[model samples]
Target chain A: MDDFKFPYFFNYPPYFTLQPVRDTREKQIQLWKELILKYCKHHKVFLINLEEEFPLFSNTSIDRRLTYESREVFLGALVSEGRAEWMDKGHKKCLILWRRIQDWADLILEFVHEYGLEEGVTTLEEIRTGDETQGTELAGIDRVVLVKALKLLEQRGKAAIFKGTSADDEGVKFSI
Target chain B: MRRRPGISGLQTAAATRDQYRSLGENVAKIRTDLMMEQLSIFRSQLEEFARKHKNDIRKSPAFRAQFHSMCAKIGVDPLASNKGFWAELLGIGDFYYELGVQIVNVCLSTRPHNGGLIDLEELRGLLSKQRRSSRDPITDDDCLRAISKLKALGSGFEVFSVGNRKLVRSVPTELNKDHNQILEIAQARGYVTSEEVQVSLMWHSGRVIDTLETLMKEGLAMVDDGHPDGIRRFWFPCVGSTSGAVEAGSELSS
Candidate 1:
């Protein structure tokens, strides 16, 4: 990562502090909103714990970390823009929807189609950890996000999740 | 012992300059070449005459009497008697050219400029007057209305001062510098002309200001720099000694 020297503005002090001035805040919010989404999409990061140190929230060299309030401000801005969401009321866990939740569900449907899994039944565990998804972006998917995408498909009556034994050992049947 | 808010026309001046220049060029183009040459010659001759009398006009008792009499008719203070050397070089040849003015106001005030308090009643009354025009017919009213709101809410605000008295903080103060905030927003939203102001207004009242500020900060709506053909480029918000960078630096340290 050091090889990719960040832009000069990365060193700008205010760039780390969440701006409160409306005009400045709008700009800072925009840059962060874009940067956060870009970073999450690249790393395939789903949950962002505001309590923990995320690389996007901390600049080690700068000795700066976004305060919890700043994180809420940025994430709250995203939620308002429909680009992200809070997983719970505590506001501690966030689901970074770099891509819209709808888009993610669409991607899952497309992936199922590409693998000729249309009308096929597969164990939920197999779909997540099996060799087919090993090298794909779907391999390390968050359980909540996967359930969400499956539920979206189910809403359209395209697929269904059935109980097997436990929560981890579930199965999905698709009707094409 | 007070500093007044910087004049509103930093943005307005940019527009007025372009407008005046374009009008000057158009007038020059429409007149015959011979007429232009003759006018130029007459102008030079007038300058020569003004220069010759510059010294005499200041020191000569006879000339001072006439000068003061002429100034009295126009209600201007008499030119200083000591106006010597440098005044001759500049020459007053353009005196008779007949400049036009859209608005002019003169008044006396007892209010202290740096009181950190703005008399809301005075500001509201001032903005509601016809003088608060944009000089562009379209958004002239909108600009006035915006100013009106700013006035009621407090236009040149400082921390609430000693009870009722308002202070006129230095123009560079962060809190008082927001008069140009609207311009900064407009620039960022890409409203390159007066026309864009109307379209952007469709979103929300705040939208116009947001775009204006963006432009000013990014130096897009800067006068004579971007969109030369457009009139919106005429207004600039950064005119005083303090600049966008200075404000940014102070904020950075904070």
Candidate 2:
């Protein structure tokens, strides 16, 4: 696994604990939110499970682990900003939309136009793991998020999806 | 014979009055002159004493504070000007002025992070860092005096106490009675829960939460939910010694 380069303050133990000072805590939360988004975007991390240990939530170099409450609060802040969503009612897992669905849809449309995939029939798996997506941000994309983006495009009449012979295989036909 | 005697007696009485008046005026003149001479002597002696202990007075905060009180008793204002016998000889005024400038620097530099409100001890620690090489030590009293001088800038610098700690506020936010009362209650234990605030302040829960929320909004207070009692404790950093609390927090986490 590639090591994510944490910011200088990441090593500071106090950063893991939620500050009690109102102004200090707000700044701390804002920094945490930014770092989380940047890290998720870089690593293409789609979900963060609070019940399970998340690497970003702890810094082994400093031996600081964020308390569960702090984790929930920080994630709660992201959810409120619409940048993230709770996957379950318990908020045990969070879907990190580092790039919002709307933005992702636009990226997909750009990819389609760039690659001349506009009138081409391609499997959903190919779009995610095909040579065309190789080295692109769409490579290794989460199927759930990819489906949601494709559905958005399908709603706009820019694309269509049909099930392939295998239940796990699906194909998309882009009209644009 | 009676008239002649009465006339002589009146003349004698007038002479006696004149003699006594002259005598009284002479005594008053000598006493005034003597007092003036003694004051000059006392002034020079004080100057000599200040000159001899200049380093002690400057290096030791307790000594400096004592010197200030002594000067106060004698109706002397050593900090009256940056240039004078006291300023030139002892330079105490310049010391405080330099401290005031450094305080402004620290407060301004940390203002973004602290929202223009800093704990007094924290400010002192930073100030000491700036003057680490200097022989003079900065104390809470020194910081208070320096901040008091910063008030001349009209930049809204002021020192106020909350609980047992002092906080320097560079903003003009007025803390009302409710805010002050809440801070006062938090001083006893470094924190106050909503129930504690309600019971001690004789206020409704709504009022207690409302004021605490306002304080939290202003970044003057912080909430802690680590307690097992399920009661959220609102901590006032400005009211409690931050170093002590930081140590306690680290200990708990460790």
Candidate 3:
């Protein structure tokens, strides 16, 4: 992973702790949410497991770390905003949708149009790892997120997903 | 001989008028001189009294407040200028000016954490720490006066009350009426519930929530979800001392 540059406030110790003041905490939470999205987008980080140490959630320079409860609260806020999702019933892992699903679906369509892939058949794996997607944001995209974005397009009848002979492989046929 | 008598009578009358005019002028001059002497005496006595109580004025908050009131009555403002006799004799002007600078420094340094708002007592504690070498005791009133001088800097420095506690705001953020009312309601226990605001302020739940949400967005309030009753409690850090809030938190947990 490349070095993730933090915003100036990332070094502030209090930013790591949950503020008890409603107004201050709200501002703190807003800043936290923005920083998290920016960091995730920059590093292509899709999942934040609360049980594990996330570099953005802890500032070693100030020796301050967000408590588990604060982590949940911040992630919960993101979930409510539709910018993230709980990966399981335990709510320990978060799927950060820095780009909303709708936007992701649009991006996929744009990519298809840009590459003249309309009415073309491609495996889900190829869409994410294919040489054609090498320099695009679709490269290295999380499989779960890609599937969800594809399903959204499928719901609209713009694309179709079919299970391949192996469970690990899936193919998407874009009709648009 | 008759003509000479008439001229003498006229001369006597003129002399009498001149004498009365001189007498009146003499009385007025005497009164003016006496008043000047009395005023000089009073000013000198004030200077002597100030000299005797210089330490008291600096060390005791009560004495300093009294001194300020006396100065007000006499129209003598020691803080009016940082030069001349008052500044030289008392150094009060420079004292507050120095304090104002230190306040700005503390506010700037803590802005990233508190968002330009700090509890007045906390500020005093920090200021006293900064001025520990001087051994000059400071008080809330002193801080108030010092902060007042800082208003001239146009830095939006002002002292405001949240509940009973005072907070110093270094930034120009406006706290609307709804925010102040919520803060005032939270003063008793350092925290307030939305239900409490609704009941006490007679505000609808939506209004209460809207106001509280705004306060939270501004970083002036904290939400506590640990209550067993499950009612979210909003805590105001600016409404009370940190230690006091900690104690209150412990009490709630217990």
lDDT of 1 by residue, B1-254 (tens): 87665677577788899999999998877786878898779656645755776665534546645654654574643222215322344322111110001111201121111112223333334333433453212122222222323333343422223223222222224432333343334335322444455464444547555654544444322332222232323342222111233344354435
lDDT of 3 at A124: 87
Once fitted onto the true fold, the runs of candidate 3 whose alpha carbons sit more than 4 angstroms away are A1-49, A52-176, B1-36, B224-230, B243-254
Off by over 4 Å in 2: A1-26, A31-51, A55-176, B1-43, B106-122, B162-165, B225-228, B245-254
Error of 2 at A98 (Å): 14
Docking level for model 1: incorrect
RMSD of 2: 9.2
Comparing 1 with 2 on DockQ, the higher-scoring candidate is: 2
- CA shift of B124, model 1, Å: 44
Query: Could you give candidate 1's per-residue lDDT for residues A36-147 as a string of tens digits?
Result: 8877887788899998988777665544567788889889989899888789999898998877768767877877898788898888777678888888777878777788
* DockQ score of the complex predicted as candidate 2: 0.10
lDDT, candidate 3, at A42? 90
lDDT of each: 0.53, 0.81, 0.81
